[model samples]
Target: MNSSTHLDLAFTALADPTRRAILARLSEGEATVAELARPFSISQPAVSRHLKILEQAGLITTAVDAQRRPRRLEAQGLAELSGWIERLRESWGYNFRRLDQLLAETAPALEPERTGS
Candidate 1:
């Protein structure tokens, strides 16, 4: 998929608090569905649904370990998102700098007012 397409999926998957929480947990280490489901009161199926969405978005991926399918954070997906955000921040910073320069040029210098003693 294209970058925009991946970003769209990632943002949509991240919109849910539960999914975000899941990602946070996976950030620490890979976990089985049961391990991930323990923090929330939700059912295993519900957690699996969230996991499916996350996997679809490329934010997480599964690995086979014996009979367990553990999920872990995908660095490429996170890095893509981070890079996009950093580009935005850099653009905004440049615009702010330009604005400051313009304001400095147009604004009059402040002079101290003397009070009669």
Candidate 2:
């Protein structure tokens, strides 16, 4: 997939709590579709649909082995997401620091006006 579509798919997949939980579970080890469905109340097909989204996002991969298709976490997509989030956080943090400094500098000037009033 192209980079933009890949990111859109990854974010959309992550937007669902159920899918996120599935990813967390997959992180421990690979699991069959049935095993993944066991923790939730949803039907097997529903879980499969969620798995499809995760797979499309490049967050997980399903491998066929005998009669079972095992799902496992694919860390690269998640790592890319984490890096993007961290960069956003850092940018916001720097802006807040600058704002704090500006407010501190203005505080002394405001104090004189308050006292005069």
lDDT of 2 at 33: 86
How many steric clashes does model 1 contain?
A: 0
Please list the residue runs of candidate 2 whose C-alpha ends up more than 4 Å from where it truly belongs after superposition: 113-117
The CA root-mean-square deviation of candidate 1, after full C-alpha superposition on the true structure, stands at 2.4
Local accuracy by lDDT, each model = 0.96, 0.92
RMSD (Cα, Å) for all candidates, in order, is: 2.4, 2.6
Q: What is the lDDT of candidate 2?
A: 0.92
Best-performing candidate as measured by TM-score:
1
The TM-score between candidate 2 and the true structure equals 0.86
Candidate 2 residue-wise lDDT, 42-106, digit = tens: 99999999999999899999889999899999888888888878999999999999999999999
List model 1 lDDT by residue over 14-49, tens digit each.
Answer: 999999999999989999999999999999999999
Backbone clashes, candidate 2: 0
